[model samples]
Target: MINDKSFIHYLKEAEQDFSGWDFSYVTDTGRMAASLLSWSYGSMAKKLITEATSLLDMGTGGGELLAKLQPFPHSVFATEGYKPNFPISKKRLHPLGVTVVEVDEDNLLPFTNGQFDLIINKHEAYSAQEVRRVISENGIFLTQQVGGADCAEINEALGIPLNQEYLHWQLDFAKKELEDNGFRVVFAKEETPVQRFYDVGALVYYLKAIPWQIPDFEMGDYMEQLYGIHRKIESKGYFDVTQERFIIKAEPI
Candidate 1:
């Protein structure tokens, strides 16, 4: 172990309290950034909300994105699977006339059949059958999912095996599942954009922020590899990785 002060400082700087699916600390400071996709989920959701009477936001983390698209429909609801985020979602969305529910299992939604006409999900898992049951006949189910291959390069960098469980989670796989669940797909697209980290600290922070990226990750376990990445960043200026994203808009047939 190097046990150097500079390295310790980087780890200390990276050890930040991340909450509500927010990564502004590193992103806003130019330490790390991801290339923009051709489509914007917010713009699409905003337009959908204007047309629908009832809306459901699945996994409304901290209600960050949902709150931005204000002047919501008559019945607005949000569901969060994470326990910690349930309170945060309620506190932020409740006052705005949004009913936030805590859902432990995505397959079993605690809602009546045909309860919503517009359902929007970002980076959240859902059962197509359950969605079809809860959404009205004319309902729209729009989702933006992170592919199983999302940032796998980071795993390779750290000498960690790719998460096998999620490795096959791609656009085609998702689209087929929705279709099988009695949905007619309208719009669908996929993208693998570039994501760059300018420093080792930023990478550390990002890995910490998203624990699933490296399951049970600890600074001590990857010290040497991190130091190597630190040297590479020092020489090459940035560590680049591919980010997988896909969008699907479907309606019940």
Candidate 2:
């Protein structure tokens, strides 16, 4: 269990950080991204909810999907590994009767095996084996991952190449890992489509959210590049940057 009140403080921090952002031009694009992500969630769990009474959403960012599913009868429990994200996500969904817990990324999940009829990890950290461990037999494992060529436009706009090789590995090796672990694959496909946005600043914010972007790229450099890109954004009115993403669905054996 998490202290929902204490979590409010973290949400405040995130809101403050996000407040400085300029989202004027890209509101539509932002909404599209949210809609697409949320749609992926609905696609994964729709069938399960018709059959089962419980679900677990791993890395339920800002509890967006959980809030969307509130009207459904399933008992939804969520876990977020990042401490900062946990509190903010809790605040977002708690009012809607969603309960989110903090979980250690490397350890066993708090719930026992076969506890949930549906287990989902949308844009969550990867611990393929851990996923195998916690899910109930025949339970669904749904995911939408950062695709191999995600955010290629940012790289192009800034005249730099970001590592997209991992996406290649995700398809090649990750699938085999799941199969060897006794899970049967259901749906797997590459969705290499660009999510359009109007505001260059909002695009910058999403780029900053990436983990590798935090460690390797200097914030000053990124801001400088973003500032330079803003001129183009102003000229064109909006940029339709294509990002590659993968959608995977599986069930435990």
Candidate 3:
């Protein structure tokens, strides 16, 4: 039984609006943290942005990360496919002189050929052909993807069935896809880092925020498992899970 008053407090905190792609709520609480990979996505992206005159940030989410890359290029553009995030992205990016566009994940982008000299994507799906269509000749494409098997341990912990969709979303598969789309793969790396949750409430908040991790997640339905996991946390200090991540840099051939 979850008898502690803190348990209810954390559960309520986890149920708030996760409108943007931000995770500061859980992260700031020091309830959860992940080990870093060998490479840094922000550093690499900053270097590329410094050199490009025109740039595009796909799936810019609330433009939180993009906003930090200030002193931007002459032309900076961002796209958000999730409708709820569109207005958020615009509000955060528009004042920075970044054009925030609403895009359909499955459709072609609205720009003309060779529109941007650099394109950056982080944890967003893209149609390779459409990316090729919009990028200028010799343009650079940098993307950091969340591997399909990311956080599979979470599913295992909760006795949830694993999905097959992301089984092949590793670095090699991403590189091959880009090459097949006429992009010359320049750099690629993959890492499976360990993440630790200090409390059951953190795990609950995470699953609730990123629903895809546990598509059918519900406190009522998984109460037994949650209680079991809570007991484990009380004994072990934390719950550990692995997260898959990969980064690829390419250029149109």
List where candidate 2 sits over 4 angstroms from the true fold: 1-16, 19-39, 72-74, 95-97, 159-169, 211-219
What lDDT tens digits, residue by residue, belong to model 1 across residues 1-253? 6876766778889989877878899999999999999999999999999999999999999898999999899999999988778888899999999999999899999999999999999999999999999999989999999999899889998999988999889999999999999999999999999999998889999998787999998988999999988878878989999999999999999
Cα-based lDDT at residue 209, candidate 2: 53
**Candidate 2 local lDDT, 12-112, one digit each (tens):** 32232432123333354452242243246575566666666667888886675666664644477888877767777888867766678888854577877
| Residue-pair clash count for candidate 3 | 0
Which clashing pairs does model 3 show? none
The TM-score obtained by model 2 is: 0.75
With candidate 1 superimposed using the best TM-score fit, by how many Å does residue 193's alpha carbon deviate from the native? 0.4
**lDDT (0 to 1) per candidate:** 0.92, 0.63, 0.88
* Structural similarity to truth (TM-score) of each candidate: 0.97, 0.75, 0.95
Model 3, 47: alpha-carbon shift in Å?
Answer: 0.9
lDDT of 3 at 199: 90
Give lDDT for model 1: 0.92
lDDT of 3 by residue, 176-239 (tens): 8889988999999899999999998889988987778898788877877877778788899999
Clash pairs, model 1 backbone: none
